[model samples]
Target: MKNKLIKMLVGIGLVMGLAACGGGGEDTASGGTDSAHADAEKIYNQKCSSCHGDNLKGGMGPELTAVGANYSQDEIADIIQNGQGAMPAGLISGDDLDKVAEWLATKK
Candidate 1:
């Protein structure tokens, strides 16, 4: 009886371990896309929204709700970095720039 109980406990532990490992950490393993997107949206809201509008539908700047359909990620980054038309340059930079560019690229 003692041996049987021990074996059963071990089996249960093994099963639990396997289940834990199989979880795949989906929230942490999705190539950082989720967090990056959230960050990008936050940044846009804080910095870009004044000109781009709260919804990217254009305020002082042109409409960008579907900018991804018209521009690639690099192109968008370039525009943000260098400024285009009435928009000023360097609103965001470094990793924030990359994250925002990548997130915006998915808008299409």
Candidate 2:
């Protein structure tokens, strides 16, 4: 009986541990403004910063600091998805594309 009770407690603990491991009411994909921004920043650093510069200033790529002023969100999204000039195509896509575009639009 004691062994059964201990096993039952262990099972309950395991179930609770699994439940706690799962994100609680958090949108793991996009979350909120802060999370989206953090995601965007991470993506940019990984993929774009090499060419666009860490602060979005010009590097091998033209300065993106004023890109928001020059291009609409849709246009920026298109450029990122399709590429232009020396820039290659399909650098980023899906939800990341949208997040990066929206985040970049706020640069200006």
Candidate 3:
């Protein structure tokens, strides 16, 4: 009887752990803004800082400190994917593009 009770508790614990594993990062549902931004900023610094500046202050590229004021997340993603003006297309893509765009969209 004790063994059966332990097994049931272990199963319940496993299910709870799995249930807490997904979503909540993108929209701040988990309140992990710093972690999410750190990840996105890491990607940005790797792929975009050379042109956009370390703090989005602009370098060879225009300042993006307020880019969200002008562009929505989808718009920013389109720009990143398609290229705009002197910016080359596809400098970043896939999940990286989505993350960067989502982070930047909050800059406003």
Give me the candidate number with maximum TM-score: 2
Q: In candidate 2, where is summed lDDT lowest over 10 consecutive residues?
A: 18-27
Instruction: Note the residue pairs that clash in candidate 3.
Output: none
- Estimate TM-scores for all models: 0.69, 0.71, 0.68
**Runs off by more than 4 Å, candidate 1:** 1-31
The RMSD (Cα, Å) of candidate 3 is 17.9
How high is the CA lDDT of each candidate model?
0.70, 0.74, 0.74
Q: Which runs in model 2 stand beyond 4 Å of their true positions?
A: 1-30
Rank order by TM-score, top first?
A: 2, 1, 3
1-108 per-residue lDDT for model 3 (tens digits): 999677556644543343344223234455476766876787777667766788999866789999999999999999999988766676667766888899999988
Candidate 2, after superposition: displacement of residue 90 in Å?
Answer: 0.1
lDDT of 2 by residue, 4-102 (tens): 677556644543354344322223565889898888877777667766788999666689997889898899999988988766666777887888898
Question: For residue 71, what is the lDDT in candidate 2?
Answer: 91
lDDT of 1 by residue, 8-108 (tens): 56644543343344322112345566776877787776667666678889765678889999999999999988877656676677767777787788877
Residue-level error in angstroms, candidate 3, position 6: 71
